[model samples]
Target: MKKMLVFSMLILVLILGACSKKEDASNHGSVNDGEAPSEFGSIDHGVDENKVGFNLTGGTIEEAANVPAEEKDLIIRSFDTYIHAFNNQDLDEYMSTLSEKPKSFNLDEEREYIESVFDEYELSREAKDITIVKFDEETGESQVFANLVTKMKQKSTGLETKRDGRQVTVFSKEGGDWKVNSVYYMEDQK
Candidate 1:
């Protein structure tokens, strides 16, 4: 009876230790630690699962690789237009790249709020390291995720301040042209 009790406790200890360690997602068929299953790349650290059900319009990964060079260039150009328009504050140009009747959220209020208080904030902005995270060839669509870092002047003594943010945009092919389908932006607190 004493031996059995000690063995049971040992097993429990081993099990607890295993549960406490971080599980490597790749070991269980997940692609990469940073590459979540969700289209938004949302990571649920607690549940070890990501949100799902984002059927973006794009060619499959295989198809995107086989895309003609000219078509690929067109897609890249459209993406460039989007980045430039945002930096230039060319709202019309930015909107033009988007799909007709596109669904836009989290912009109106945010923009109004920023515009209203921008004067109070010091602004030194730089957008760097824009990269194509993923593309689909079958649907001729792609997702562009970029990181933006900015420096906001400190209020009191005019010292420089810093801020960072991430944005994800979905672009789709329409009538042989690339257009933005949607956007998600997030800013980190400085």
Candidate 2:
């Protein structure tokens, strides 16, 4: 009787594991029926998953548009500088655009990763539809959204890969200068 019970338990556990795996597989490509969740909540923007870029929907765009023109321009300029620095492989220039105290990752880790990427690959990036998704003058914090396409070629093999995604870069004023605090990216489903 003891042996029979143990075998039955093993079979039940295996069945449950298989069911879980199947469920995960079914949800691999999209989340919440084509809407991706953000820090704010699910964004059901009806963005075509197969498309190469992202689009902002609902009140997010309106909120960004209400920010003062000067503040919005400053944030866009800061983001442009960051992209230019990365494409040029200028480590110092790129680092200058980021906050000394970052919220997403350690500064040292970022530096090391950027150094490695520069050494291993030649990269080019294009940013389009840049917008300020949110801004708070009181806190000196903002979120800049962009649709980005990056192409990277390996130095040794000459193999190239292209990535397209939507990115939200969080910025905060450090000593009166807007610096990048964190970045979140969601790759196109395709």
Candidate 3:
């Protein structure tokens, strides 16, 4: 069961990552509303040390507090809804937190993958060190980094597995709402 879970997660990551790269490449030169392109690059890449921008990669509460109150509240609320809905296996509510035009994967692909997970396992996830690592108001994009602890139990065999990881969830504004655009997760090495 643990092996299967790990395999599934690995596949999910690869597929979504590839989709994101393809979408970004295709939309590289397009600017919205005749506005200049954002200085901040894609969140999938590592942060550059020299960039003159928010440098809150430490994942601390103090760092997160530097973000504007309204934006911070909305981002965190959306993230919380995402986790809670997934744990509860509420598909509609879970999908609500994701963007209609996601950078990582299409809505249907995400729905199918998540549905499979929901059908096979019961998941409980807790997030800590939630911090806003980056925010670009002009682009309406923000990257929230967090430490995640998850436990999953196979529905059929009752086998359980646990994992700890660091996750970066990039949120983008769509229709005046902050929705999850992409995610990058790295599991802790044991």
lDDT-better candidate, 1 vs 2: 2
Q: Scored by Cα lDDT, where does model 1 land? A: 0.54
Which digits, one per residue and each the tens of the lDDT, describe model 1 over residues 23-43? 764332224443423222221
Relative to the true structure, candidate 2 reaches a TM of 0.69
| Candidate 3 local lDDT, 71-183, one digit each (tens) | 88988888999889988989899999988888755677577768878888888899998878778888898877778898989999999999887677889988878998876
lDDT of each: 0.54, 0.72, 0.71
TM-score of 3: 0.68
Tens-place lDDT per residue, model 2, 1-190, is 9999999999999999986653433232234334333321112233432221224332334336567888887888899999999999999999999988886556776777688889988999899878786777897888888878989899999999888777777799888689988776666778
For candidate 1, what's the RMSD?
A: 11.4
Ranking by TM-score: 2, 3, 1
* TM-scores for candidates 1 onward, in order: 0.47, 0.69, 0.68
Clashes of each: 7, 0, 0
Alpha-carbon shift of residue 95 in model 3 (angstroms): 0.6
